[model samples]
Target: MISKEIVVANKTGIHARPASMFVKTATQFKSNITVTKDGKTANGKSLITILSLQLVKGSNITISADGADAAEAVDTLIKMVESKFGEE
Candidate 1:
């Protein structure tokens, strides 16, 4: 498994549209992905699971991937969050 903790950069954090985008992108990889916020964790490929977390700006979470392309998955996702989901 590969994991990295990063702050939610989007001003609105992960919600609705951004959450959908995240879930969609996560599914592009064959790796098993999980995102954890606080004490809660969700399936990174499920939009419902992600949106239910209601993550907010400044929140810290860990993104992890395990499988064939774990390293690339983690790195790409880190870059996505750092992009603020285009809210930048």
Candidate 2:
């Protein structure tokens, strides 16, 4: 397993578009990915679960993955979050 923490930097946080982009990226990996916030965890590949996080600006989140490509999956997600899903 691998994990990385990041802060939500986008103005709108992980709203519909960003959550959709996140899900799209997550589904590409063979690893099982999860996003966590304040002890709550969600399947990274599911749009609904991610939206449920209600991530707002400055929210702290952890992206984690397990399986063959765990490290890659975590890194990719960390980058995506750090990039603000390109919304900024």
Candidate 3:
């Protein structure tokens, strides 16, 4: 398993578009991806699960992955978060 924390730099956080992009990126990996915030963890590959988190700006989220390609998955996710989904 691998995990990394990222602060939401996007003003709107992981709202709508960003969440969609995240879900898309997650599905590209074979690893099991999960994102947690405020004690709530959601499946990264599922759009509904991510949307359910209701992540907002400045929120601290931990993105984790396990199984095959775990490290690569986590790294890609971290890049996405750092990019702020182009929202910031």
Highest-TM-score candidate: 2
Candidate 3 local lDDT, residue 78 = 94
Measured against the true structure, the TM-scores of the candidates, in listed sequence, are 0.95, 0.97, 0.96
> Per-model C-alpha lDDT, please?
0.89, 0.93, 0.92
Model 2 over residues 1-88: C-alpha lDDT tens digits? 8988899998988899999999999999999999999999999999999999999999999999999999998998888888988877
lDDT (Cα, 0-100) at 52 in candidate 2: 97
Q: What is candidate 2's CA lDDT for residue 62? A: 93
**Which one is best on lDDT?**
2
Candidate 3 per-residue lDDT over residues 1-88, each given as its tens digit: 9999999888888988999999999999999999999999999999999989988888899999998899999999899899888765
Residue 16 CA displacement from its true place in model 1, Å:
1.0
lDDT winner between candidates 2 and 3: 2
User: Per-candidate RMSD vs. true structure?
Assistant: 0.8, 0.6, 0.8
Give me the runs in candidate 3 sitting further than 4 Å from their true place: none
Colliding residue pairs in candidate 3:
none
Check candidate 2 and list the clashing pairs. none
